[model samples]
Target: MTQPSREAIQTLVTQCLQEILNQRGTELSAPLTADTPMFGTGGLLDSIGIVTMIVDVEQTIAAEFNATVSLADDRAMSQRNSPYRSISALTDYILGQLSEGA
Candidate 1:
């Protein structure tokens, strides 16, 4: 199977985040972007929100890409830069995981 492009992964991530936010009836002061912070200081999501987003992203990836990935795995946590730091970071991480599995 062909691995998904970064843009596709990014779109998926963004969709998952929006879905999660909508479910919780949360709204952001600004529009979501590649630089939008998902975790850490000034982040949009709290710990529980981040976890929920991760799980939703993972499941979406599985269904869309036919690839199963653990977004919050040890490898992700051990990275120098966190995958959960921003939308772009998470997209890159998911693309990497899909590439590896391919």
Candidate 2:
């Protein structure tokens, strides 16, 4: 597959987050965006929700990009700034992973 742009990855990440919120019957005061907090203070997701999102994202990426990625692996945990912190961070991390695999 051709390398995806940052916007493409961000869009995919946003869609996955929105889907997870919808599944949980959540209605946000604001739309989910690149700056939306994901797993920390004032975040949308709890531990379970984060886990669900991770699985959903990984599965969707595999289907969409035909590449398998482990989003919550050791490397992710060891990062100085967590990729799960926000949509933008997650998108960047995924983009890097895809690039490395390519």
Off by over 4 Å in 1: none
User: What lDDT tens digits, residue by residue, belong to model 2 across residues 1-102?
Assistant: 788889988988899899889999988998787999998788999999999999999999889888888899999988888999999999999998998988
lDDT of each: 0.89, 0.90
TM-score of 2: 0.94
Model 1 TM-score, all chains together: 0.93
Q: Relative to the unseen true structure, what is the C-alpha lDDT of residue 72 in candidate 2, on a scale of 0 to 100?
A: 92
Which segments of model 2 are wrong by more than 4 Å?
none
